[model samples]
Target chain A: MNTKTFETENQLIRAAQAGDQQALRELVEQYSDTVYKFAFKVCRSEDDAEDTLQDAFLNILKALKTFNHRSNFSTWVYRIVSNSCLMKWRKEKRERWESFERLDNPEERIQDSYTHWPDSPAEALLSNELQEKMDEAILDLPPIYRLAFVMKDLEGLKMEQVAQALEISLPAAKARLRRARLFLRDRLEPYVQS
Target chain B: MADELKERILNICSELGEDIDSADCKKLRQHVASCQDSSAFVDSVKKTISLYKAYGPNIDHDTSSRLLGKLGLD
Candidate 1:
């Protein structure tokens, strides 16, 4: 839990529940960057991320009155965002599975994200170099491992948050992260030497 | 490239609990300070950190406004 929520967050929660739109807006705005990032990362598409973002807060707002203020607002929102994003991910995964005919041939369908960072970063060359290596490394991870690594390492979430978000146990989170790191290390070894 | 060292660092990254211990933070800091000693190793570390820093969306105000609007907060 962050300090902002620790000290007198109940006031804001009350304000939000009482129909203070700005309070709700402040809360959403503060967390939206992270939310949007996560949505985009999971969906790998702007349209989907946009939809995920809208869907998340709309869900939150609809249930705002009944929301227990005991948990941190950030945690609550992370729960919402993660649920929505994972649902989208599951949908996509399902689509891919259907297309693959079965799960055994996933390697043939794996998206090789070459040149992903070239157009996505402030400094083109460095971004391209790092992202090329990084994407290859991350894409090499298994489904569970990639999700854990992305949630913890990429999104700066705590292990507890990752476990909570993914609805898995803490030890499960740790194992996946370990798997991701080993996968990345192997993928990155040659590039790091260059 | 000992499997053990790689396993250890990966464990550190994996065990990123909500409350990071001060000792863990200190160890990370120490590693950071010496990261530049080897280009390859530094690059390896940089790949992960840079990837983490790079994960967010490059969204615009138009999209933001639309999202906010849909949330009824615009």
Candidate 2:
């Protein structure tokens, strides 16, 4: 969410919690993109993302009455979507056990890596091919790392928020993000240099 | 010493856009300026993140309305 929308989000949350249906509709409109994008990135499938998105908002409406306004509503919604994404992954058997291994061993760096920064990466990334490669690289990441990276980097969540969403320690979230960056750097090095 | 420097550089890269003006970051910036490898590492990581940031995706209108309809908000 952008700064402007985030500022209003709290008000909407309070209003929605107070049984304002219009506020609830506004909240959904504001967050649907963020939630859907997160789901698509994590689930890597449009159908799965759509399912998760629908379930997330429905669950949000059901749970809104119990929301105590302790945490940011966005963070609470992220927790819901993250849970939904994980459940979908588990049912699909997409969450690999090795993701935990990679998360545990931060010392193991990407091997045989060579990278030369492109002079115009912003321009280079505009190309459809490179964008597709970047998307694929993200999808190929281990689920743990992917979630951390997507939440922190793509979704623009703070480290603490990411940790909260993923139900991990702050340090664990940081480690996963670092490893995810290194892993993606290795995968996209060829394109960067070319 | 080299491994430690590399680790510090990578850590700085990970912390990009957060606190790039800290004493340690200033020192790392100087080190990067003097060292080609460190500079390359920092630049590449920044580029990688920029690419990721540039690829924003939006929810389709149909999907949004369909979801809203299901929730009876439409």
Candidate 3:
């Protein structure tokens, strides 16, 4: 919320709105990395992520003129990218999904031993096994919930911002986040706690 | 641990959010101090989030450049 930063963003938006190609490019460049990372996390495939990124910016380009600027530019960008991701991938069917009741059941979590996972050192977190498990766990989530989880947890957006970006009510967003976290925690339990 | 205690502790942990000083979080911590299952569950969930938060893989340089080209901005 620095005044200078906010003013600079305002300037950039005005320039882009006025058909300044350089301004448009600066806008894209500033957000491209974030967009790509988010797309990758949601789509969980390089090809899909790339396509989503391209589709997202194309949408941004088309909508920039009428953007009304109601939301900040970053939130607007996230909204577009999240929509692109859902539209592109939500149709794919999964073999099965863990039910919410099953995930929340205490009986399902009752392991004989109650040891916690080791402190995840940076090395372990960056290791291939952990990364692959995280990727698989994310992909296993239904697309909508996956988007919510990625936005709130991985991207570190606030709960309100997540609801805004996803066009959902705050409680709905929180529900998705809680379930997504539960699913992921269960998937990772054997790997970490064992 | 009784199933009731287990469920209560996990519920508290889930609702804790990021406010460590909140009353619910304080209660959860107090319960976790005496409950191994609660302690393990909290630790593992925190670990899961931290692990995935570290799993960011960027688009390669070539891919980024190609994106710009596709957009006719290069």
Candidate 4:
């Protein structure tokens, strides 16, 4: 199923690479949700995510002609979005640092307030409350870990693809993903066990 | 011993049923099934991943259109 879709996307990419404006538009439309969702999760802010989305597409357009097709188009786009998000994060962090003299204590940022779970563990795990908690937990992860988690687990990218997108080694990507999953598992253990 | 096995199983299980198709994945699945703790850990991680999979945040149609227009591609 996924392989067929990937092949189709590759065909469209080939067309777009040949200067087919319609094909390029179609590609953007097809990948918009994917890029937007990934951006939203990684940036943890809708506005920043939107900005990243815009910047990514613009860069994709500029680079489309030079695209060597060495990597999957989706992987290339992910790399673009990842870079945009990181740039936005750094810019924001710098601005924040200039505005505020001191950073908040990291210990204070931990979320320890637990919600009561329902009687059935299955029911509790499936509940919207748990989903919200999980979302919050994902957002709370450190930026690199969160990106690894989002790309591998949420975006359903392959580990190799995640590594390529992040410009990291395969082992490094796997380690980050493992740590991210462990952190999430530990955070949600109470609700899952309840 | 079980804790280490569970952790190792989890690291492999995370990539299972997805793009991974290695012999290691098959072996890990068999091991996870035989062990109670590893089985539960696999199930929990699967559930956690499913929640993330179900999260669909669509980019508004207008947003895409606006982006295209801004890029002079429309």
Candidate 5:
């Protein structure tokens, strides 16, 4: 949600909790696209994103009464959506940190030797090719790291709020964000240079 | 860059958290100015994030409506 809408979010929450269907609809309408976009970015599959969107909203409605406002509403919703994504893929092993070994050695690419992109990010338009690379890089991250990266870097959440949403320590959230960022930077190196 | 310096640069880049001009990032800004590799690495990381941010996909109207319908809010 935008900052202006968030200024009045508490009032909407209070009304929704009081069984006000209109207030509840307002919340759903405002957050549905945000939730779905986050899910799609993290899940990377439209089908999975849709399923997560439904599950997250249902969970949010069920748990709304107990929401004590400790974390802001968007953070709470992110938590629910993250949990829904995690649950869907719990049986899979997602910790793939070892795959990052190839990109770990920044020492090899010294100051003069660093790969320079042909253009700055601002000058570069969003080509379909770069978009695919971005999607592929994000998908390559482990789910835990993906969640932290998405919430902080992509969704523009604060570090503390990201920790709250992911149920991890502040430092742990920072670590995940770091690894995810470096992993992506390395993945896009060749494409940007090319 | 040494391992220690590289680690420090990466940490500073990630923890800067989109607020490059914040007071906390003063040391990072200074370091990037002096160090070419760190600057490139930091710039690339920021670019990676900016690219993703620029290309963010929105939930189509029909999909969002279906979600609301499933929740009985439609």
Candidate 6:
């Protein structure tokens, strides 16, 4: 949390922008945590999150020369990370969802695996019944709604940032959030009273 | 009665806002109140939060070290 660390980071970015190899590597080390977490929030698995992190950093490295200084580094990096995650999700969908129906309610096709991360044991141990029920609730949500829930509710991203990352209009993002909340309320009715 | 409770829940959500542990939710303690339904509510809410805490990539501390080793920072 030192000011010095941040200052050093800013300087390193400037150097990395100019193609300094070491600085670029340092930048990767510094922000990869954010990239991985973002991916995991969406992907909900360790292996996928790890793949997304490495791919994001690699993409950033490839695209560094075109890096614009006008944007916040965090935001720009998020764009790259978000794109990577989306692509990965799309790939997974293609593999598993070729014959799947796209429901307007968005809850019809919720992925059961969204609730449980295969690699996380603690998530498994947190109250076995609760975890299972939670997973079912998440899966009950539609993809857009689930993504909105994960992005805004869980990842703590603002509406605007989420819209940018998802490449959607602000209103669309808000609508999705509403749907996500409504859907969760429906499924949670049996479980929560107060 | 059910509708009233639902309204209260939604109002609590609106007043407290969304993050499972928002300042308002924490301050009011309404969402996680000690009640039959409240327990289940908290349990489910926590499942979401715990998904991030446990499965989120930052939980992978070994990543930084392993990444450092790969990049020769180690």
Instruction: Please identify model 6 stretches exceeding 4 Å from their true place.
Output: A1-9, A94-125, A139-144, B1-62, B65-74
Tens-digit lDDT track for model 6 on A2-59?
A: 2224366567778888877677667877687777777666665566667777777777
lDDT of 6 by residue, B1-74 (tens): 35355445534654455554667866656534666665454455554444434554364668766655654545
Choose the strongest candidate by TM-score.
5
Compose the digit string of candidate 4's lDDT tens values, residues A71-164.
8878888888887777766765433223111222223233432322224555444676675576556655666777888898888788899999
Ranking by TM-score: 5, 3, 2, 4, 1, 6
Q: Per-prediction DockQ, in order?
A: 0.35, 0.40, 0.41, 0.29, 0.47, 0.24
Clashing residue pairs, backbone N/CA/C < 3 A, model 5:
none
Superior candidate under DockQ, 1 versus 6: 1
Worst 10 residues of 5 chain B by lDDT: B17-26
Clashes of each: 0, 0, 0, 0, 0, 2
How well does chain A score by TM in each candidate? 0.70, 0.73, 0.78, 0.72, 0.76, 0.73
Tens-place lDDT digits, model 1, residues A1-194: 23244255677778888898777886677667777777666555567668888888788788779878776666677677777756666766644434222223424435533433325445454545666555544444445566666676677777887787677898887877666655665665655454
lDDT of 6: 0.61
Interface RMSD per candidate: 3.6, 4.9, 4.6, 4.9, 5.0, 5.1
User: Considering only the true interface residues, what is the Cα RMSD of candidate 5 after superposition?
Assistant: 5.0
Candidate 6 true-interface contact recovery: 0.26
Which docking class does model 4 fall in?
acceptable
- On DockQ, who's better, 4 or 6? 4
Estimate, for each residue in A1-194, the C-alpha lDDT of model 2 and write its tens digit: 44333366667788888877787788889889988888876765677678999989988889988878888778888988877777766676564444544434433333221122233655453665675566566666777788888888778788889889888887778778877777777667766542
Candidate ordering by DockQ (highest first): 5, 3, 2, 1, 4, 6
Ten residues in sequence with the least summed lDDT for candidate 4 chain A: A97-106
Q: Rank the candidates by lDDT, best first.
A: 5, 2, 3, 4, 1, 6
Candidate models: Cα lDDT each: 0.62, 0.71, 0.70, 0.69, 0.73, 0.61
* Candidate 4, number of clashes: 0
The estimated TM-scores of all candidates read 0.69, 0.76, 0.79, 0.73, 0.80, 0.65
Number of clashing pairs, model 5?
0
> Worst 10-residue stretch by lDDT in candidate 5 chain A?
A108-117
